[model samples]
Target: MKLHHLEALVSVADAGSIRAAARLLQLSQAAVTKALRELESEQQLALLVRTAGGVSFTDVGYRLLQHARLVVGQIERASEELAKLRGDQAGKLAIAVTPLVMVTFLPETVSLFRKQMPAIQLEIFEGLTAVALPRLREGALDFGILALAAALTDQEFDIEPLFAYESRAMARRGHPSAGKHSLHDLLDQNWAVNFTPASYESLMQDLFWQHGAKIAPARLHSTHSYSLMLELVRYSDMLTVAPEPLLLTESMRNWAQPLRLDEQFGTRRVSVISLRNTMRSQAAMCFVDCLRKVIRTRSRSASEANRMLFDRLELLF
Candidate 1:
């Protein structure tokens, strides 16, 4: 019936026991029990059944717990917004990003955003869109940056296409295949492929197959960590795929080289994805602006080699 009642019920469900919930809520055991009882009385439903180990929610109780979580989360977000409106500049922004973005532009964007909104807390989750979308829909993420599987419709999300970059094959600086320009020359080498959604992976696979080459089962390794993939390429004979800009970093270039593969892997679209119904807070909007500026600057200053590469691949847009 009351906020505290909902809070107590949700906490108990999360903590799995009244005593644990009391500790988590920083309230007395009796207080937590009383709140749960009062909530049940008001709802006219038996919410929880106690046991020696902990507790279990009744079927109805479990259903109410889901609603309770949303209510508590909304209240917390509302409080954060109110604080921001008071000129506190203090709020939380959670962003989900693909690993490519994490390595390429996110750090610079975060740095610039933090300088402008120092009081705002930023949480970044790195994953493919498939992993991030459900969380974004559930209100866990404020926004995301990744390659979309399909064009966005206004019914589900507000999608803004940012930029597309060519995917490049990378190898250790002294790799034997460094001078290999043809896909056939590199087909025999081991590979550490970035794990994207299946749709994107299929696209990549098609690129190779279309070029008369196939990534061998014994030679392929898949991962979501850009750093690990880079390391594998650096320390071993493994090859990996990444955006040209990511491979061109000075630190990365010191250990690895973007191979001049004669095959085109087609540009991947990176976009900003946010829930359609959610209103963007001032802080969230500011961060999005920061991201846009960073991308624009990088796109404008792309190297001549990258420019030519993009041009050749028809990815200049």
Candidate 2:
């Protein structure tokens, strides 16, 4: 099928009606309908059925829709790639960042990315693994910085690992469990955990198992909202497992204390992921580069401080 045919099909699938798709493409509804007809005629299969609201994809149509999405997405990326090669500072990059990243290095990444690609537009939003994966598949998002239980395996996406995340099981200062020096001692407390469909709850279970316990907290609550989870820990007896970066935020640094457990969590990671076999435009790479630079800068600062302390101890000896 022609580019316009695939475009029309993709638009209709997204916009739900020929009329609305026309609005999106800035074309007449009749032109869109004509394109769809030409496509179906060539395929020799009925792709869509009319509905009172608009149209619905036929069984085969549903399968074809994915192909259309990929083709359409590739074309857009091709255009961006060509523009980038020509040294043109245009086109857009859309990315999703998890809440942990937002509170930590996002501002630095944004500033650094803009210094490299000043004219490129950026669209970023808060999303977790569940919201990000499907959008990545649909070509709705260009890049994602997502939290994962570990490095993702061979999926439809290419993963560039950022770092292994360190987590702390924490509670409000003066919490009874805060002073408990072993996971076994805190086992009876209620806990609020951050989890998504991608299964970060397993991280909590792993926390106990790593500490030589076989079970999770006595009472477990799962929440997707970081603020909600933190507030629960602050106001109530609920403790929460949070990324170490989250604990460094101004509000949490003052209000929360890490549970004095003998056991630490194993590896969870935050990484940059994008659709595989697709062109990564210059702007997208620049953003990833900036993210790395910020992480390095932060790491170096911490290392230098440790070095200074070590040097002081050398003089003492």
Candidate 3:
């Protein structure tokens, strides 16, 4: 019936007990009980069934909980929007990013964004698209940069393609399999891969299978942290699959080398995605623009560097 009642209902459901919910809501147990009773009386529904251990939702209660989540989410978003209007130049911008983008242009983009919007607070969540996209939809993130298998529809999100990059096998320079020309050649060595969703793992496996080599699951080392993956490849004979741009980083350039394979490993499409109907704050818009500019500049620089390297190779030949 009231917002507090709804809050109490949701909190109780989450905490699984009246006592725990009271502690979470910072209220007395009696007050919480009174609120719940008032709410039930107003709605004329048995929302919860009490058990010896805790509580469980009734059929109608389960449905109401879903609506309650949306209502609470909307209220929170509204408060944030109002705060942004009041603070014009300052607000929080939350973005989720995949590891590839984090090691590529994100550092430069963040540095430039700080200079342009000194008052804005930036929060970054690092993960794969599967982990980030649900948060994006739930309004926990302003936007996200991730690799997608297919194009997103306008009805769900506004997506801007930042870049498309081919996945390459990389290892520390002078590794035994560095000179290998096919997946079959490296099948005996241990490998590292990003700990993404199952679909991504399948995609990687499919690539190897397409090349007539199937990587054994026991030989694969999966990690969620890029730094750990890099360290593993640098210190050990472990090989990893990564975007080519990631290998060009200053920290990785000297220590790692891309393995030239006889077959293509396929390209991934990375895009910046935001909820279509949501109103973005000024800080969010500024950050997105900065990201676009940085990616464009990096793309141009990479192209130029490649051209220079080709010219030198031609002279040597």
Candidate 4:
């Protein structure tokens, strides 16, 4: 009848015994038994049957267990919502961000979120698209920021076009190839690559192939750290491909400069994805708005930087 009683039954069913459930729930064994008895009395059904081995859920108990999980989940969500309404921006916000965004935009986004809603807990996970999409559907992530493509299929997710930007190749600003007029001229140059089996990987590889250049296998293959990749390019003649916004950041630009490839190189759209069916709290909605703002500001900056860079060179492609 009560949430705690339902919790007790659910715990006992999961742990397979009263004593085990008590240990797991940090409640006394008698308390667990008493709660279960009360729940049964209120419901007027034998929820569990005791055997020498342990307690097993009766048919009604099994059905009640399913309902109990939903009830408990909703109750917990309500508690969080109520706390937020009471001037406490306290709830978990687990987001999956691509490696590039985590480096380029996440710092500013998180700083703004903390300033506006300090009590809310923030957790960010960085992986290429392969790792993030599956986790998004499994409820491991509350939302995701990833490149939009046909392969990222999730009917349960509501995908919004966050922004669009071009992906480009970059190297150290004063490197010998910086002034190169064509992608062919930089073929022999070492490149820093972060290749994974995702849309971004295919896009970069295709761009290179279009320019009649292949990624040099002997060059440095990098982990998904944009900062580290930029560092490598800054210290060496190595080139790496990055999203335009990332390469345009003032700090990021000091380390890596965009390489002008063929004119056919195109832009890609990044999307914000979240579960469609779930009811969102005010705090969750605010976080999503903050992310949109970050993307808009970053995208505008990238466009301005692209114009300035094009001024100094032909920007052939």
Candidate 5:
């Protein structure tokens, strides 16, 4: 089957409607349907079933989409390699990013990469772990950065552990618990939580529950945006859990108070994830290498500092 037919199937599966897929690909709805029929005929298997919700993939259709992604990725990688061999570091890259890490991390990384390799083209799409992982598998993104574990059951992805960071409870600068170190003291106040149920939000709640503590539904619940949560903290005594990297920014430091728990909650691993079976595109490899270098440098320094701090604490003890 033609690559366009595969592209149509993947786009339909992702967009979840023939109309939506047609809009995305700038094609007529009839054209999209024809493409699907062509793909099914070539594969001798049905790829999609239409229902009230839209076009959904059949079991065989899902498997075909996976193979299609690999094929398309290989074609792109071959082009990138040829470009590199011609001494031109030129190709397009698509990245899926989350807001917490996306704020300063990716912009800085992309800027630096562009300075060194001016010919490279870049595109960034903001999405959460739930949405980004599927797109990465469908060959919609060259790489993804997510704050979840590596063992994804449905997708064949290679995860490179970047760094582990801790999430802490944050409040206003002069809040009651600003000087407090006890978890009990903080929980007594109204909460400003940063997640929804059955996802990141629920995961945060579960982490605390696992540690024998529980929080009531927040007076305010948030997604990933810290600015809104920071505003809530400033105006009221609301406390929300925030990743250290995001909270440590200078903008929030003046008004934000970090509340330390006796037991660490919300320790998360961030990683650079890519499809395993796809041919490694030159642009993809270069970007991954840049991420690894950045992580290694930061982690090594952090490790050394930790060792030194431990040695000093032992002496005092």
Candidate 6:
């Protein structure tokens, strides 16, 4: 019913218990309990069910909690927006980016952004499209730098393609799959895949089939952590499909190299994805501009650079 009501509800869901939720909200346990009761009384529905361990949302509770998260996130962003507009130069932004972006030009991008708005807060999550989409929908992220094939046609998002990069099958330098110029050489090796938006297995299958090679890896491990996926490949015989430029880093280059296949993997565009029709705050736009500037400075795109996208976006903001 009220901002605190929604905040209380969302906090409980995240913290898992009344006392912990109270701590998170910086309110007393009794205050949080009263707020929850007030919200329930007004809604004429029970939003949470008690459990010995903590609390779990009922089916209806769970459904409403999603809305609660969206509302709370909006309130927070709105506050940040108001502050930035007032020339306070203080705001918060959260974004999810792929491992490639996280390790690559992001450092330079952040440096550029912070110089202009040093007080702006940043929360950066290293993740793929699979991890980013849910958070973006919930209003938890201002935008996401996600790896996607082709241009985005999804009506749910406003996609701004930044640059193109290739994915490669990588393994430890001396791994049997390395230096092999044929896809068939990888058929018998172990494989690990980082969690991407689409099913990596089916994607790989399509790749293999295109080349007239059928792959049945000795083992397949799907990992949530990109670092773990790389580590899996580095320490063991497991081969991983990751951004080709990932191996350009000193740490990765020391232990891993891309499989020298005759058939190069297709290029994927790394784009900024945000909820459709939603206008970003000024601070968010500044951050995006920094990304575009860095992309141009670094010249990372595999395809011919298109200045139109960047120019249009900057003019819009």
Off by over 4 Å in 1: 1-75, 86-88, 98-108, 127-131, 148-155, 179-188, 196-218, 296-317
Model 6 lDDT per residue over 230-266, tens place: 7788887788777776766655868888887887667
On TM-score, who's better, 2 or 4? 2
The per-residue C-alpha lDDT of model 3 at residue 239 equals: 89
**Per-residue lDDT over 197-296 for candidate 2, one digit per residue giving the tens place of the 0 to 100 score:** 4555555456665566655534777666667777899998787776665655665878888875667765567788888888887788889889887766
Local distance difference test values of all predictions, in order: 0.75, 0.77, 0.75, 0.69, 0.68, 0.76
**Model 5 lDDT per residue over 214-269, tens place:** 65654445544445556777786787775666654555746676776676664566
* lDDT (C-alpha) at residue 141 in model 2: 78
By lDDT, who's the top model here? Answer: 2
Q: Report the Cα lDDT for residue 265, model 5.
A: 68
Residue 315 deviation, candidate 2, in Å?
29
Minimum summed lDDT over a 10-residue window in model 1 is located at 308-317
Ranking by TM-score: 6, 2, 3, 5, 1, 4
Which ten residues in a row are the worst by lDDT in model 5? 308-317
**Candidate 4's residue-wise lDDT over 93-126, tens digit each?**
7778876567656788888878888887877887
Mark the regions of model 3 whose C-alpha exceeds 4 Å error after superposition.
1-74, 87-90, 149-156, 297-317
Candidate 6 positional error at 195, Å = 2.6
Native-to-model Cα distance after best TM-score fit, residue 247 in candidate 4, in Å: 3.9
Question: What are the RMSDs of all candidates, in order?
Answer: 5.8, 5.9, 6.4, 9.6, 6.1, 5.2
- For each candidate, give its TM-score against the true structure: 0.67, 0.73, 0.71, 0.58, 0.68, 0.82
Over the full model, what C-alpha lDDT does candidate 3 score relative to the true structure?
A: 0.75
Candidate 5 has a TM-score of 0.68
